[model samples]
Each structure stands twice: as C-alpha cells, then as structure tokens.
Target: MNYETFAPHPNLDAIVKCHWILEVPGDMEAPKQRVIPDGCIEMCFILGDDVKRFNSENEFIIQPRAMVFGQITKPYFVKPTGYVNTFAVRFYPYGFANFITQPIHELADKETPLTSLFEESSIKELEQKIIEAASTKSRIAIIESFLLSRLTDKSIIDNIVTSTIDSLSQTKGSASINSILKDDLSKRRNLERKFSKQVGISPKQLGRIIRLQAALKMMLNKPGENLTQVAYENEYYDQAHFTKDFKEFTGVNPKQYLDNDQMMLSSLIYSKD
Candidate 1:
C-alpha cells in the first residue's frame, strides 16, 4: 500500500483539506487498512480494479469507480479488487456541502456516482480530466477551476448553517450540540433537517466524529504516551469514555491500535490534517 497527499492551492486553503493520491498494488490485502469514521466527505476516482464497501452483514457490493462518500457516521471497510489505483479529493468537514444540494446522508453506506450527484456534464468531464492528468498540477487545476465556478455566489451560505460551522471550527469539533444550539433553540429541529439535506449527517454527529479524529491524532503522534492522560487532555469523561469513542469510530481499542503493525488509511489522513 502506498499513500500520498498533495497540498491544496492557497486560494482554496479554507475549504479543501487536500488532494490525495492512494495506490495499492495487486496482492496488497489492505485488511487492516480501515477507513475510520471521520466527518469529511471524499470524492474518489478509481483507475484500476474494482473495490467493494461491505454492508452491515459483511456483504461485498461493487461501488462506482468514481463516486463521493459523505461524512461517515460509523467505521467502514474497503478492499481493492486488484492493483487498486485511486485518486481522491478529501474535502474539509464542511467542504462537500458546497457542491451538492440534496441530502448528504444518502451518500452513506453506499457509493453514489458523480453522475447522479454532480450531474453536470462539465463536472463529469472535470473528474475524467483529473484522473487522466499526468502531473499533480493538472489535477489541482481541474478541481480549482471547478471550485471557482461554484464559488460565484459566496453569499449562498445561510446564516444558521455558517454560524454552527463557525462554532464547530471554533471548538475543533469538541463542542456539544446543546452548546452550539444555544444561539437558536427554536432552530434545533430545522437545523438537522437542513443538515440532512445539505451537510449529510447532523451537526452534532459530525462534531463527535471530528473530535474522534483529534483524539486519535493525539494518540498516534506520541505512541508511547499514557492513554488515560491522553483521554483527559482530549476532554473525555474518563479513560472508559475515551475508549468507547475510539472503538466506535475506528472499531478498535487504543491499545490495540498502538500495537497493530498495519497502516490505517483514516489515521494517515488525520495525521496530515
């Protein structure tokens, strides 16, 4: 398994997290290469063999070679068909919301083709151009161009949504729903309705997942650090609380996560962030 991440253009620094390229050669089982739950949406283009995302029953189903995965609410698995080569654009926590208008949560637990979501013939051409680009510069240019087209109306971002996003960024995903919702208690139910339509998962759920990424990074950065201390520093109620959140997101305990020799796709992405 080989992974690489490219820095975003200066103009897009606030929205795009980064553009990354991941290539897994044939016979690379990628068994422990788990995609931990993170509150970010990603667009992937497969240049090689088929890949499958398992269902709750562990059933494998073919996913489109080109698709977008919205903020994952839970841990999920991906195994390459053979010699998988994927070029993906990983958006910031709120990045994907800028592109699609329908329910973001529908992207969960399945692969939705770029054709169905972006729908624009131009959008399809942009993805193809990116995948075919010989140099990273060309790929970046393609996405940057697309973003420039979409940002024509920066004012389209609504007040309620942007404020909640500001709250999340301010807390680094550590803030709770009750605290963030204090601004507009009456909008609580309406907020989620908009979130489901625009942001994918509810804001609270996205915050929790984002917080897990933070905690995981703290642990991975200092592999030999004390787990309980790490938990406290991350604001978990206790070691038990930390452990539960960790398992819920990565489907593995911190201790086991530390000792495991296999590379974690999610952790790799988080560390870069």
Candidate 2:
C-alpha cells in the first residue's frame, strides 16, 4: 500500500485540506481498510477496480467510481475488488460547504454520487478527463480546475464558525465550545446553525473527532508511550474515557489498534501531515 498527500494551490489552501493518492499493488492482497471520522469531507475518484463500502456485517455495495464521502460520525470499512488506484480531494470541515447549495449536514455518513451534486453531463465529462490524464500532476490540474469552476460564494463562511473551529483545532479539541463563545453566550444557537450548515456536524461532534485524531497521532508517533500517559497528555478525564472514545470512533481498543494491519492505512494517513 502507498499513500501520498499534496498541498493544494495557495488560493485553495483554506478550502482544501490536501489532495491525495492511494494505490494498492495488483500483486498484493487488498485488505479491508477501516476509516474513522476526522471532521472532514472528501471527493474521491476511483481509477481502478470498484471498491466495496460495508453497510452492515455482511452487506455492502460497490461505491461509485466518482463520489463524495460526507462527514462520518462512525468508523467504516472499504476494500478494493482488485488493484486500487484512487485520487481524492480532502476538504476541511467548512471547506466543501462553499461549493454546494444544500445544507452540508444532510450529507453526513453516506456516499453521494457526483451526478447528484453537479450536472450529470459535467460530472461525466470530469470523470472522463480524470481517467484519461496521463500522470498524477495532470490529474491534480484537472481536479483543481473543476473545483475552481464550481466554487460558490466565498463569502458564505461565518466568522463564528471559523473562529470556533480554529480554536478547537488549535487546542486539539480540548477547548470547550462554551468557553470559545463565552464573550457572546446568545450566539450559541447561531453557532449550532452555522456549523450544521457549513460543517455538516455539531461543534461538539467535530471537536470530539478532532480530539480523537490528536490522540491517534500521539499514539502513532510515540509507540513507546502508555495509554494512561497518552490519555493524560491529551486531556481526557481519565483512561476509561479515552478508551471509550477511541473505540467509539475506531471500532477497536487502543491496544488492538497498535500495529494492527487493518488500521495501517488510517494510521499512515494520520501519522503524516
């Protein structure tokens, strides 16, 4: 398995987290990869065989070759049918909302085909262009052009939502939303409404996911650290609280997550910038 991420053009830095590519060698077995919530959204294009997204213990459907994966609250599994080559655009919590007209919350926890989000003819044209691109650089250019063209009103970003998320991220989700908005208590309801519309999740939910990512990064980077210490450093109330949240989003205990093959993909992605 190979994964790499590239920074977006300077003008899009605030809107796009990064552009990434993943490939699973045809000669190797394609293992089921578990993906957890990270308070972001993604637009993915599969350039190889179709992948399966599990909806239940024994049920799944082939994911569309071109689709958008919305804000996920729980962990999910995906496995390639064969060789896998994919190019994806990852957007920050409030980034993708600028490109679409609907309330972002409506897209949570599911994959929506690109045709549903854009004109069918345009989506079809974009997919063909991406597939025909001769190199990764060409693909990146194609995707950026499409995104630039679809960009909606950039003024839609709310200052409250932006500052709240910045605080949550800076503190690694340790900052309480109330404290972040203590200056104007009356704006809490407005904050919730803005977050739901632009971030696709409540501020609290996004904070939890961001906090989990912080913990995961610590665990991955410092393999020698113990869970008790990890929980303390990350500001969890206790070891149990940390473990419970870890399991809730990752579908496994911290101990099992260490060096677990199923978690390799997610671990690699998080371990890097």
List, residue by residue over 154-252, the lDDT tens digit for candidate 1: 454556776887787677677877788876678888888777766678888777776777788887777788989988877788999989988887778
lDDT of 1 at 33: 55
For residues 1-273, could you state the per-residue lDDT of candidate 2 as single tens digits? 789999998878999999999998777774688999999999999999889999887799999999999999999998888888999999999999988899999999999999999999999999999999998899999999999887757888888899999999999998898899986778988999999999999999999999999999999999889999989988999999999999999999999988688887898899995
Quick one: RMSD of model 1? 2.5
lDDT (C-alpha, whole model) for all candidates:
0.75, 0.92
Candidate 1, residue 270: how far the Cα is off, in Å: 2.2
lDDT value, candidate 1, whole model: 0.75
Off by over 4 Å in 1: 27-29, 56-58, 261-263
RMSD of each: 2.5, 1.1
The TM-score between candidate 1 and the true structure equals 0.87
Clashes of 1: 0
